[model samples]
Target: MSTPTQKHTKSRKNIRRGAIRLKKISLANCPKCKKPVKPHTACAFCGSYKGKVVKKVRVPKSLRKSKKQEKSKK
Candidate 1:
């Protein structure tokens, strides 16, 4: 096993620890819903990707029936 030869200074240790801190993730807005979403991925709320619907997200059972009825009628 190997170890650092000299004891690290406070600033040097702080600088290294600061660099190891977690970076905040940046999100982009969904075009359809205008909600924040991770880039290059589908929107969780609207289930859209690049202006197209790529996935179908489920709604609560109470809201689901209304949408299903409306869709069946169309």
Candidate 2:
């Protein structure tokens, strides 16, 4: 087994860890739904990819709610 000969300084450790930090994911708007979605992936709201419908996404009328309805309820 081998151990580090010297203790790493706080700033040095932090500098090395800076590169391991989380990176913000880049997102693109879905053309059909205008919602933020990961690029090269199907739009979850509209089920479209690259201007083509790849999957059929259906929301039942009862499940679908509008802002007007929510505001009225509130």
In candidate 2, which residue ranges exceed 4 Å CA deviation? Answer: 64-74
The 10 consecutive residues of candidate 2 with the worst lDDT sum are: 59-68
Please give the clash total of every predicted structure, in order: 0, 0
lDDT of 1 at 47: 98
Scored by CA lDDT, what does every candidate get?
0.96, 0.90
Which lDDT tens digits does candidate 1 get at residues 1-72?
999899999999999898787779999999999999999999999999999999999888999899999999
Q: Residue 70: error of model 2 in Å?
A: 17
Summarize candidate 2's per-residue lDDT along 1-74 as a digit string, tens digits. Answer: 99999999999999999999788999999998899999989998989999999999988677677755898899
What is the model-wide C-alpha lDDT for candidate 2? 0.90
Query: TM-score, each model?
Result: 0.73, 0.71
- Which candidate's lDDT is highest? 1
